[model samples]
Target chain A: GAGVSQSPSNKVTEKGKDVELRCDPISGHTALYWYRQSLGQGLEFLIYFQGNSAPDKSGLPSDRFSAERTGGSVSTLTIQRTQQEDSAVYLCASSWGRPGSPLHFGNGTRLTVT
Target chain B: GESVGLHLPTLSVQEGDNSIINCAYSNSASDYFIWYKQESGKGPQFIIDIRSNMDKRQGQRVTVLLNKTVKHLSLQIAATQPGDSAVYFCAENSGSNYKLTFGKGTLLTVNP
Candidate 1:
């Protein structure tokens, strides 16, 4: 694909339900990132992947939030027991992670936990 | 509790006028800075980036200036247009790492 792609542009789920968001990064991009944006808020880093290495999960807001990148390409963010506060736009970005490489972003998945 | 913040929440400008959005970062170890523009219901798009080694960088109609001395970064848009209305965010990368810390963002409304 020419750009990073995310699945299910919008998702409406009841509170306490589990939601899975998928992201397909640009081909040949070795680094992928997950971020969350609350209403009128900035992008909050959630996780980062470098090839097949263990992801940097320090940014996950809670234990309920987890993500995995497979084959250094596609990635999934799983939010368990989603709370109302979990409602937000989940964005995915990919970059080469080389010197001076900028991140390319996907349209994002808007999750509404009612 | 470290984060980047913007000095202004919203900026309104007339078409063709120049616009400036300012940001302040708390992390002194941040070495790389990037500016992004996001439209309604869309993801952020990279605008310009500047490394700690340099104080300024220019791209298209946007110029990003970094003042590491005061931990301040600013994006200046020349001849702003109605199409330029969007939210702008500044992100900082930790020294020698690409982990980005983003600012709250400033809404730029260019009135035609």
Candidate 2:
């Protein structure tokens, strides 16, 4: 694809439900990342992946949040036991995984936990 | 614990006029800086980037200036247009750490 793509532009789930968001990065991009944005808030880093190395999970807000990148391409972010506070936009981005490579972002998925 | 932040939360400007957004960072070790613009209902798009080794970089109508001594970074938009209205964010990267540290964004509004 010409740009990063995310699935299910919007999702509304009841509190305590689980939600899965998917991302397909640009072709050949070796690095992928996930970020969250609350209403009127800045982007908060969640997780990062480069090649087959273990993802950098330092930014995950809680144990309920986890992500997996398959075959160095598509990625999924799963939020378990979603809380009302989880209502926000989930953004995905990809890069060349090299020095000076800028990240290309997708439109993002807006998750509303009611 | 954000290491980067903007001085203004919102900036208003007339279309065709120049606009400048300012940001400050606390990490002296940060070696790379980038500016991104995000429109409503969309993700952030990279504008321009500047390495710590240099003080300035220009791209089309945008220019990024970095003052590592003061840990300050600013983006200057030339002949700003209504389409340029969006939230601007500054991100920093230090050395081999590929993870970027982003600052709270500044909303830029261009009035026609």
Candidate 3:
């Protein structure tokens, strides 16, 4: 892909339901990241994947939030038993390298938990 | 739980005027900072970045100033336009992993 691509542009789900958001990073990029932004808020880092190594899960808010990157190419963020507070825009980004390289972002999936 | 935070929630500027958004981060270890512009319903777009070693960096119509002494960062936009109206965010890279810690964004509106 020319840029980061996220699936299911918008999702409205009931509280307690589970939801999955997918992200396909730009081709040849080695680093991928996930972030969440609530209404009128800043981006909250969630997770980061670098190659096949273990992900940096430091930013996941709680046990209900989890993510996995398969084959070092695509990634999925899963939220279990979603709550109303879970409503937010989920964004994904990718960079060709690390630290010094700038990231390219996806349009993001807006998840609404009612 | 500490992170960067914005000093202003919103700023209104006349078209063609200059705009400045400020951020304060808590971590002294943070080595990298980036500024981003996000429009409605869209993801954030990178504006410019500055490392801890440098006090300033410039990009097209944009400048990032980092004041490590005060743990503050600011983004200055030159010749603001209505199309430049959006939320601006500042993010810090605090660790070797380079995960970002973002501040509450500042909404900039260029009134024409």
- Model number with the top DockQ: 2
- Compute the lDDT of residue B44 as modeled in candidate 1: 95
List per-prediction Cα lDDT, in the order shown.
Answer: 0.91, 0.91, 0.89
Least lDDT summed over 10 consecutive residues: which range in candidate 3 chain B? Answer: B93-102
Q: State the interface C-alpha RMSD of candidate 1.
A: 1.5
Task: Compare candidates 2 and 3 on lDDT and give the better one.
Answer: 2
* Candidate 2 C-alpha error for residue B17, in Å: 0.7
**Which sections of candidate 2 miss by over 4 Å?**
none
Pick by TM-score: 2 or 3, better one: 2
Q: Can you list the residue pairs that collide in candidate 2?
A: none
The TM-scores, one per candidate, come to 0.95, 0.97, 0.93
Candidate 1 per-residue lDDT over residues B1-112, each given as its tens digit: 4679999999999999999999999888888889999999899998999988999999899999999889899999999999999999998887666678888899999988
Chain B of candidate 3 achieves a TM-score of 0.96
User: Model 3, B16-99: lDDT tens per residue?
Assistant: 999999999988988888998999999999889888999999899999999999999999999999999999989888547467
**Residue A98, candidate 2: C-alpha displacement in angstroms:** 2.0
The ten-residue window of minimal lDDT in model 2 chain A covers: A47-56
Maximum-TM-score candidate: 2
Interface C-alpha RMSD per candidate, 1 decimal: 1.5, 1.1, 1.6
Candidate 1 stretches greater than 4 Å from native: none
| CAPRI class of candidate 1 | medium
Each candidate's fnat, listed in order, reads 0.56, 0.52, 0.64
